[model samples]
Target: MTESQDLDLTPRDADDVSVGRKRLRNWLIMGTFTAVIGFVLFQALTSAAQFYYNVDEAVARRGELEDSTFRIQGTVTSEQAPDANGALIFTIAYGGVDTAVRHVGAEPSDLFEIGIPVVSEGHWEGDVFQSRQLLVKHSESYEAENPDRVEYDLDDTPGYVPDNTVE
Candidate 1:
């Protein structure tokens, strides 16, 4: 029988060991980068999700939502004319709860009337919801109410002034 020679398969020099360690380190770094990128993507997607709260729900969760920006949808009950500073103060109610809101920067839409549904976006400050944007929502199919006008003669008035006078 001929003599058998054994060949070692393991790393024989420091360079071989270093190369192996370098490959391991690269893999670890790439895995870490992938994990970080995935985590950031998840956070970005979740952070962009917006939520809307009703008046009653908002009032109930005021403490928790005080610092968060959200939308509140409700029916306008009463509103006051803009103050000297052009800030409109209105009250909206839903589910038997009323929420006071203060809107600045712009006037409410013409369709924003009492008893109409509106959505306000802002955060709560103390007990009031401060908003810079207000959306008035109307049904897709809307019909205007037409009422008959009463015919009245100006001569019936005790004292009447005419815009145009002819000799």
Candidate 2:
């Protein structure tokens, strides 16, 4: 074909060009959609930080834990005598571990006794934890005489007869 008398790159039918353009547009649109979807999915899977903290986690992350109010789950470690009428004192036991906590408030509930698991919420003060609230877990063991299992007079007042009596 002679130079100017010759080739037309454009398709003879406008419809063909339009169809090709439509296909290109569709490809572009699909690419944008795919990118957006992938980004949202990635964010969903890898966003927030999680922690199942224990005594060790707290002790290990002591600096971070000092001012931040978080969770501490432990058992009553050793005997803690509540001040004549002041705070409830005990230690939490968890993860083969324990942490001392002193809770000051009204008289503790019946469940607040030795050897019972407790969940306390509060801030750690120096070496000891000063709990704002105390929650006690029930005992798993059974006693035949005391089926009710409501048995403990920690104060051991003169008139108090413990439900669990010695034979």
| Backbone clash total, candidate 2 | 5
lDDT of model 2 at position 118: 67
Off by over 4 Å in 2: 1-52, 139-167
Q: Candidate 2 local accuracy as lDDT? A: 0.63
Top candidate by TM-score? 1
Tens-place lDDT digits, model 1, residues 1-167: 23335655666665877988989999999999999999998987875465467888998999999678888887777778787888988887776677678998677789987667788888999988998789986757655565775543533322122331111
lDDT of each: 0.75, 0.63
TM-score of each: 0.58, 0.49
Model 1 clash number: 0
* Most accurate candidate by lDDT: 1
lDDT of 2 by residue, 85-157 (tens): 6777666555554567778755557866655666566677886777777766565777677678776543332
Q: What residue pairs clash in candidate 1, if any at all? A: none
